[model samples]
Target: MARLETAYGPLPTDPGEQSRLFYKIYSAYSDRVGVLDAHGSYLAARDIGIINLILFILLPGFAWWATADVYRAAMYACALFSAYVLTAAAAQVYGVRLVENVLAAASADHD
Candidate 1:
């Protein structure tokens, strides 16, 4: 597989180093543009819709159908919400990495 190129050379194999390098490049590119802001807004809107669906529809239905207890449903919702937030955060980081790679690739090609 082809390795990703950046200003610092090939992407690091170590997870910690990779994250640092990606953020470094991403910051440089984002400082010149509003890509991060746009992406964040998009994610925020999507999260709002997902949260609404979970709290308003799914939680109520789950409570009525399975638990028949407000407390149990609330606990379940909290766990589910926590998991969703973690997944969303991971997705956001992955998205930023993708954008960073694209920008870095383009910059490498341009130069």
Candidate 2:
């Protein structure tokens, strides 16, 4: 398929094509770094487990210990969890943009 032209450069229009391109980039980097079988699922599972541990148990426990009020602790936990979620989302976006910019530069060089 022909790539879609943009100010940045040519970009894949098909979702599957873009995914494959990204996979190739990641695979090359992983192979060079000797990270065999580096998969998103593993990273995601680890992140989720850590987040859950902190969000569901540690945060509330610590908050309660500090505040000694169940309602206040609950509110504090909720606020902290919301901030964590937003920060994670922003980081994800930044990572995606970094990858996109790298791909664009690589493609531009090839052209």
Candidate 3:
């Protein structure tokens, strides 16, 4: 039996029969972490999002302070950082959906 550790506690092996809510939450989290496959893709995307978010908060001000062309170069940098954030977010969402689909297929196979 495969066991899943959740925020509440360890999920029952027979998740579908034991607790629907816990199973759903566990499924979502498992997908988010790419536990089944893609290894560290989810973590990589999360890290990218965090780094871009931090840069978005700090870099614009630093750019403005360093150069008088705040409107041009700073704005461009901010836009680029925003793009990175969006891309990371998209990747995470995609990964989660992919995992969910795989889990669903596996569940169907078991049934």
Candidate achieving the largest TM-score: 3
Which residue pairs collide, candidate 1? none
What is the Cα-based lDDT of residue 87 in candidate 2? 55
Supply the TM-score for candidate 1. Answer: 0.46
Q: Candidate 1: global Cα-lDDT?
A: 0.63
Q: Residues 1-111, candidate 1, lDDT per residue (tens digit)?
A: 133453467767999997797677666666443565555655775676477546654665567578678777777777767766765675577566557554655475445
What is the C-alpha lDDT profile of model 2 across 1-111, one tens digit per residue?
123243334566799987887776555455332223223434554476457546765778888998899999988878767766665665565556556554554454444
What TM-score would every model get versus the actual structure? Answer: 0.46, 0.52, 0.54
Q: Model 1, which residues run further than 4 Å from truth?
A: 1-6, 32-34, 49-58, 61-110
Off by over 4 Å in 3: 1-35, 98-102, 105-109
TM-score of 3: 0.54
lDDT values for all models? 0.63, 0.58, 0.61
Which 10 residues in a row give candidate 1 its minimum summed lDDT?
A: 1-10
| lDDT tens per residue, model 3, 1-111 | 132332334445685755675456446545543454543666667777777777777777777777867696667686968777786876778677655654554444443
The clash numbers for all candidates, in the given order, read 0, 0, 0
In angstroms, how far off is 45's CA in candidate 3? 1.1
State how far residue 26 of model 3 sits from its true place (Å).
Answer: 5.2
